[model samples]
Target: MSHSMRPLLPNSPNPPRIETSSSSSSSSQHRTKRVATPAACEACRRRKSKCSAERPRCSVCVERQTPCEYTTLPTETHLRAQRRKLSNLEIRCQAYEDLFGILRSRSEEEIAQILQRLRTGEDAQTIVKTVQDGDLLLQLSLKPEFRFRYIFPYSGEMPRHLKDAQNPYIRSLLYEKTVTHLVQPPMYIETLKEISDESQKMYIAPYHTVELDDPRISSMIVSNWTTVSSDNPMLRMLLQIYFVFEFPFHPCFHKDFFLEDMFIGITRFCSPLLVNAVLATAWHGYTRMKNRAEYWQPHNLGYRFLAEALRLFELEQETPTITTVQAAAIINLVYNLNGIDELGWVYTHKSFGMAQKISLFTPNPEESTEWQMVAGVTAWCLFNWQALITFHTFQPPVINDPPSRPLPDVDEEPAYYGEILVKYPFGKEPVRIYNGSVFKAISQFRVILNDITKSFFNPSRTYSPISFEAAIEFRSKLRIWYEDLPQPLQARHIVLPCHLKIHIHYHIVLISLFEPHLHTDNAYNGVNPDMIVSQSRICFETLMRIYYLRHGFECLDTTLVQFLHLLGFSTLDEISVTENGSAANEAIRSTLMLCAKGLWEQGQNYYLSEAVFRMLRQSMSVEDVTILGDIVEVEDGDGPLNLMAQELRSRWPIGAFSKADDSKDRTLEHFIHWWQQYSEEKAQDISAMEQDGPVVPPRYPQRYGT
Candidate 1:
C-alpha cells in the first residue's frame, strides 16, 4: 500500500503505538482540571490550534506575531436583557412612526381607534395605556400645530423687544425635554422642574433639587433611596443631607423626631461625615459654649444625648489605646452637666461609631506609647460608665418586677472594640494616652455590674438577693487591676482604692437610685419625713467620715484635705475647750460618736440603730485624732435615730448580727431577727461611708482574733 494511505494496526510490529494510545488515555483522565479550559484565540482558531489567554500575545500568537481574541459564553440573563432592550426600541420606533402618520394624515378618529386597539394588546407601548394630563401636555409640546397656542396663553400679545423670551410654558416644556425626559421611570418632568425652581427661590441655596406635587411622592423618593442603600459616595452624600439637614434642620420637622429618637436617627441614618460633624459639634459646643440647657434649642430636644454618651463609652472600652483622657473628661463633663437621671436613656441604644473607634485604637505593647494607653483607658472608662449606668438603671426594675415589657430592645450585639480597629477610609484615629489600666479597671467594674445585674434578673431561685455580692466582686476586680499597676503610675494618677468602704458607698448610692424606699422599708408608716431626712444625713455623714477615716488628714494629699476642711467640715471641740489636756482623745471620741449617731438615727434601719449606739457607749481608745477635727454635721434633726433604736432593741439584740456566730445556729426566727438588724446596720454603714467619702474601720482592738 502507499505510505499516505496506510493506517497503524495493533497486531503490527509497532507495540509502541498501542502503548502510546493507552498512556494518552491515562494522562487525560489524571490531568488537573480547570473551571473551564481556555480555548484557542481567534488568531489561533483561524490557524486551528491552542491559544493561551495571555497579555499582548498567546503562545501561538506570540510565535506567529498575530493578534488574539478570547471569547466567553454570554449569560442567559444578559442575552435576555439585550433582547428586551431591542424589543422596546422597536416598539418606540413603531409608535413614533404611527404618531407621525396620524399627524400627517390628520385622521383623528382613525388614530383614536388605533390607539384604543394598541392599548388592549399585550405588546403595546407603555405610553399608549390611559392617556394622563401630563401626556396631553407632552403632546402639545410635540405637535407644532398646538405648541405655539399652548405656550402663549393669550391670543396675540407678542412684544417685538422680547423675541428671545418665548412663552413660559414652551420654555418649561423645552427645558424638561432637554434635561430630564430621557431619564427612565417617567416622572412629571415639568413638576420636578417647578419644584426645583421654587426651592431655589425660597431657600436661596443653589443645589440639585428634585420636586413633586405630591408630598407623598417626595417622601417615597427619600424612603426608596434609603431602601436601596450603598456605601457609594453618592449614596453617602444623600444620606448626609437626609439625616443632618433635611431630617434635623428642615423647616418642617417630624413629630417622631423626639430628643432621643432624633439622636438615634442621626446615629442610624446619617453618613459617617455627618455623624462625626454632629458629634464634634456637640462635644466641642458643650465643652466650650454652655450646657445643653443653653446650647441646645427646644427643637433639638429629641436627640438621645445620653445614649450617645453610652455609645462612646462602649467604643472606648473595646479599644482603649486610641481614646484619650480628654475624651473621658469631656464625657464625664457631659454626664455630670446633663445630670443623668434614668439608666434606660443610657441603655436605649448602642453605637457603631464607638465600636469603630475601639477597633481603630486597639493597643499594642511594643508600638503603643504611654499617652496612647492613657487615652485608650479614658475612652474605655467612658464606654464602661455607659454600660454601668444602664445596668444600674435596669437592676431595680428587674429585681422588683418580672418585666412590665420585654427589656427595651436597646443594645443588642454588644460590639467588640477590636472589630473596628482597622484603619478607616477616613484617616481619623481616637485620642491616645498613657496608662490604660484605669480604663481596664473601669471596664471590668462595669462588666462586673453587668454580670451581677444579669444574675439578679435571671429566673433562678439560687441567686442571692444581697447587693453586696456585686460590690464585693467589683471591689475584688478593682483591687486586682489597681495593685497590678506600677507604683509610679498609681502615685501619679491617684489610683482610687478598691476598699470595702468605697464599695459600700457606691452600693448605697446605687440602692438609692434604684430603690429609694429601701432606705426606710423598716421605718413606721414608710412615709416619715424624719426618716427621709435621716437617710440623707446618714449618706453625707458616711461619705465624709470614710474620707477622714481611711485616708486620714495626714494620709491624704495635704492640699486636698485642707481644701476639704476649707469647704466646711469644721471640728466641734477646739484645743482651748479641752483644758484637761485630753483634747485628742476627747475629740476622737466625739467624732466617732457623731458618725455612729448619724448612721443610727438617719438610716431608718432598726438593727443598725441599736448597734451604732451600743458601739458608741462601749468606749474604745482612739488612734486617729485627725478624724475628730474633720467631722461635718448631719444638718438634720435626730428623731429617726431614737425611733429606729427603740424598734430594733425591742425586736433583736443590742449588738450587730455577726454572721459567723449566727450561721450554724441560724433558724428562720433567728435569721429574720438577725437580718432585720443586719440589714439596718449594713444600710447605715453604707450610708455613712457614702456620706463621709472615707469609711472608718471600727476602733476596738482585735475583737475577731481574740
Candidate 2:
C-alpha cells in the first residue's frame, strides 16, 4: 500500500508499487485443480511412464516440454460415452420385454423352466439373443409366410417339398400330405397374451393418435385411435378368421400391406373403420355355443366392433381414405350376412360413392406405384360384391356399371395364401390357403359377371329387357368363363372352399339366367333341364355331403346363404306344390327337408338363417308341410320346427348331430350319409366317364374382355 513508508492517501500521485505477500492471489486460481495431485497427468498416462503426482504438470510432461493436459473429456466426448452406456441399458430392457412376451404364452411348466434359467443367473441379452436366433418359438411371431403370391401358378419350378408348394392344392393332392392344421399359429397378442377380456376389452375410449407413417392422415385420424388400443383376444380371433376366410373371396384391400401397417402403428393402408368392419364381418367366428341368443344381440362381439366402425365412419366421412371406402364395403357385408339387406344396399351405395369420390374407379397414375400392387383392387372388389348382392335381391345396381379398372394382375406378385379352416373329403378340417391368385381368377370371371348383371338388372333394364338372345350371349360368356378358369379353379378342382365358391357363384348366375327359362325357353331352346339340375344338385349336394368338414355349417360364407336361398326355393317349389303324400313325393320331400335342415342348422348360429328359414316356410302350404311333416322343419318358435325337434328328442333320445340315427332315412343324419354316398357314386361315374372320354377343361373363354 505504501512506498518507503510514506503516507498513502485516497488520491496519491505515485501510488503504484509491488509488495510481496504469501497469501494474496487471483480469485481464478482458487478453482479446483484440473489434474488430481495423486494421479499422473494425461501426458504421463498416455506414455505409460511413471510420474510424480503434481499440482499443474507432471515431471514427464515437463521433461518433454509439452502442454500437460488433464484427463477431462470434452462435452461431446462425455455425451458419447454416456450415450453408449444408455444404449446398453436400453438393449437389456428390450431383451427383458422380449423374454417376458415369450414366457407369457408358454405353459406353466415352460414358464417354470425359463424362469428357472433366468433365476439361475442367465443374462437377459444372452438369453434373448439365443432365443431370437434359434427355431424354438415360444412367443407369437409372423407365421412363416409362404409369400405364395410370388409363386407363379404355372411355374415350372417343381416344389421339392409339398409343404413348400405355393398352392394348397399341390400340398393336398398327395396321399402322404393329408395332415390338417386345426388352429392357426398365434398372431397378435404378442405382448398381451396374459391380458383377459377385461384387461384389453375393445371399447371406444379416450383416444390419442398413434405415431403414424402416413402424413396424409386427417385431423380426425390424428386425434383418434385408428382401432382399439390393444389387440384383444376377440380381435385376434376375428383377424384370423377374416384374413383366412373372408379376405380371399373379397380381396378388397391388400392383405400384406394392411398387416405390416397394423403392426407398425400406421394407418396408411389400415384404419379404425376398416379393422372394425373386418372384425364385424368375421364375427361369424363366434361359434362357441351355437344356441346362445348372443349371436344376433347387440352385446355380441361383432356388433360392438361394428358400432365402433360406424362411429369412426361418421367422424371420417368428410375425409375418407381408401381404407374408409374398404371399411364401408365390409360393413355392408356385415349387414348382408345379418340379412339386413336394405342397410347392406345402402352401404353398398355409400361405399361405391366414396370410391368414386376418391377416384378409385379411375385411380391416379401415381396411385399405381403406391404400396399395394393392386391399388384399385378395393374399388374392383367393392362394386363386384355389390353387384352380386344386387343380382340376388333383384335390385338395381349401386352403379350403372363398375368403372373399367383393369383386372388386378395377381400374378404380378407372389400370391399370399391365408390359411383358413376347410373341411375335406378326407374327414378332416384341413387348413387351406385361399390363394390370392384365386381372387385374381375371380376378378377375371367378374368382368363377364358384371356384364351379365348389367344386362339383367340395370336400372334401365325395362327399356332394354333381358331378352332370350342377350341371355344366350351372357350364358355363353359364363360357360366360357368357367372353362377358362385356371387349372386349380376348374369345376372339378375341389382343393379350396374358394374354388367351390367360384363354382357355386358361377352356377347361381347360370340358374338365375336359365331357371325361369327352364320350363319354357330352356326346354325349347336346346338348353337341357338335366344339365341345370345336375349342375346345382352336384354343387349343393357336395356342400351338404361334406358339411361336417366345413365347421359343420357355421355360416362360413354369408354369400352362400344368398346362393342357397335361390337354389333352395326353386328346389322346394317343385315339391311345395305337391298335394298327394305318396311314395312318389317321399324322396323329393326328403330332399326338400334336407334343404330345410341346412337352414335349420344355420339358424343355430345366425338370425339371418332364422329369417331365411321363415321366408322358405312361408312359401310352403300347410298341406306341403304336412306332406313333409316327419322330415321337414318349418321355422323356430313357429311351433312346427320346435315340435318336430322335440318329437324326435322325445322318441329317439338323440344325443348330438353325429349321434342321430343313420337308419332313419328321413332324418338329416341319414340324408348326409345318403348325399355322401350319392356324391361319391356321382364322382366315380364322372371319373369313369372322363377316363372313357376325357372331358377336357374348356378353353380360355373367347368372350373375355379387359
Candidate 3:
C-alpha cells in the first residue's frame, strides 16, 4: 500500500505490477499476450497454405518471396469459372462490335446525338416515337396525286365535254331535214311496201329432211354386236385397261349403264359416239402398253375408230347430247396425249361449243342425278381441256364462262360398282382414289392458272409483266394450297402416278410464277436471282424424279413439253451467266441432258420436246457433252427444229461458248448445220406428200381382237 497503491492513482505506467503464485503468474502472462485470427492473404489462399498473422505481409508469402496482398473478395479457383468469365467478356465485345457496325453508316453527328440522349437517360421508345412523328414522315404519308401536279392542266373529261357541246349549225340542219321529211311523204315508205313481199319470201325457205346415210354408223353398229357376242378377249383386256388406268382419271359416263349396254347387246340404248370413242381410247392404251408405234400410223385401228367417232360427232353436231360432248372431249384428250396440240384444241373448242349450245352448265332440276353427274363431268372435261391448252399456248382460255353448276363434292361417297369400279383393285380399300377429289384439285389449279394468265399474260394489258411482289404473294398462296390439300389428294396418300402429276403441276406453277422475274431489272421488285435458281432447281429436280420413277413417258403431254422448254432455256441462261461453275449448275446441266434424252427416246411427236432436245444438244458445253454423251445428230423428218436453236443462239450467245472456248462454237455450228439439213429434208417430204395427195402408211390390224 505504501509505494504501489500511491503510484497507481494517475499516469504511472510502472506501478501496476503485482506478485502471485506460479499458476496465477502463468494465467496473467497468457492474458497479457493473447493472439487473434486474421484472414488469409491472396497468395496463401491461392496456394492453399495457412498464413501466420503478421504486419503488412503474411509469413508464408514473405518466406516464399512472393507479393502479399489481402482481400475480402473470393478468388476463383476452378478452370470452368475462368472460362465463364472469358466468355462473358467476349460476348460483351461482340455486342459492342455489332452496335458499332450498325451505326457505321450513320453520320457522326447523329450517332453522337443518339449517344447523348442515351447518356441523359432519355427513353428509347420515346425517342423513336418523336422521330417517327417528325414532318418528313408526315409528308411521306400524303397521296402521290396530292404531292405532285401534272405539267398539263387538261382534265380527263375535257374531250367528252367538247363532244357533248351541241353545235347550232348541226341543230338547224337537223330541223330542216325533219321538216323536209314531213313535207315529202317519204318515197322510201312505198319502196319498203314493194320490198316487204320479197323480204317475206327471202325469210321463208323450203323444209326437207336431208337423207344422210353415214357408213361409219352402220359399221359401228355391226362391230358392236359382233364384238359383244363373241366376247373378244383382246377387246375385253383393252376395255379393262381403259377402265382401270384411263377412265378413273376422267369419268364422264354412268359406268353401270355403259357396261350393261355393252354386255347386254343393247344397240338402241348405246351411243355410237361414246362406243367409238371408247374403242379408240382402248386401242391406244393397249398399243401404249405393248410399246408399239402402230398408233402413229394413220390407218391403225385406233385411228380408224377415232375417225369413225369424229364422223358420228360431226353428223350429230347440231343436236349434241351429253354423250356426244363427252366423247368429243375424250377424243381431244387423246390428241393432246399424242402431242397433236392443234387438233386437240380444235376438238376441245368444238366440244365447248356443243356444251354451251345444250346448256350443259345449267342443267334442269327434273333430270336424274345420273344426268346431272354426266353434265358435271362434261363441264369439268371442258374446263380441264381449256386450262391445259391455255397453259401450253400461253394464251387466254377460250371457254372462260364459269360453269353455272357446282362441282361434285369431294365427300360424296361412291354407291355403285360397275365396269370402271370393278377394275380398280383398291375400290373397297380405305385409301381408294376418288375421281371427285382429283377433279376438285384440278378445278382449283385451273382457277390459279386462270388468275396467273389474266394477271401476267393478259392480251389487253400488253405492258404488264408479272411484278416480283405479286409473284411472292402468289407463291405463298400456292404453297398453302398444296399444304392444305385433302388426304386423298396429298402426295403420300395418292397413287404414285397421280401423286407425281399433282406435284409436277404444283412445281410448274411455282416455275411459271418466278420465271418472269428472271428477266426483270427493277430494284423495287426485289427479284432475287438466288431464289430463281432455287425454284428452277426444284422444278427440274421434280422432273428428274418423275423420269427416274419411270412415269415420264406416261405423263408426257403439252404441259410437259412447255415445262421442258422453260427448263432448257433457264439452264442455258444459268450456264451462260455463271462464270465459276457450281455443283448446282453442273447438276442442272446433267439433269437437263437426261431429260432431253428421255424425251427424245420417248418420241411423243411433240414439236416442243423435239425443239428442246435439239436446243440442249446444240447448247451443251464440250465437257457436258463428254459427261453426257456426244450430241447425236439424227435425221429427224419432223418440221424445223432450228426455230428453238436459232432463238437460243439469239437470246444467249454466251451459251455457245464453254468457259470462253472456241471449240464449243464449232460444235454448236455443226449441230445447227445438221438441224438445217434435217429441216430441209422434212420440208421436201412434206411438200412431196402434199403434191402426191398424202402418203398413207400401211395399215396395221388390231393387236387384241379381229
| Candidate closest to the true structure, highest lDDT | 2
List candidate 2 segments past 4 Å from native: 1-231, 289-296, 371-374, 415-434, 457-465, 521-551, 576-586, 618-706
Q: Across residues 1-706, which tens digit of lDDT does each residue of candidate 2 receive?
A: 8568767668878886564563335534665665433445677777888766554776777888878875533333334656767877865665675576556534587577777889989987676556543321221122222210111111212223222233233333221111232222242233223333321211100000001112222111111332432223223444655655567677678776776567666888877778778767766744443432233456565666778898989998788888888888888776655645445656777877777787787756565455334455676677668666555444456665665666544455443322233221111123334365576667666667667656654455542336556767787787777777766565434444566677667755665565544445345377674466456554544443232232233334555455555545555545544545754355444445555656655665545655555445545555545544554444333243322222211111111111112332222223223334544565677555568543322111111111
Residue-level lDDT for 64 in candidate 1: 80
lDDT of 1 by residue, 385-503 (tens): 44444342333221221211111111231111111011111113311111123223334445555555555444653333434334344445555654564432342222122221223
lDDT winner between candidates 2 and 3: 2
In Å, residue 518's CA in model 3 sits off its true spot by 3.3
Please estimate how well model 2 matches the true structure, expressed as its whole-model Cα lDDT: 0.51
> Which pairs, if any, clash in model 3?
none
Candidate 3 Cα errors over 4 Å, as ranges: 1-231, 247-261, 264-270, 287-299, 415-431, 457-464, 469-473, 491-495, 519-533, 543-547, 550-569, 575-586, 604-706
- Model 3 residue 276 CA deviation (Å) reads 2.8
lDDT of 1 at 363: 44
**Best candidate per TM-score, number?**
2
**How much does candidate 3 score in TM-score?**
0.52
Ranking by lDDT: 2, 3, 1
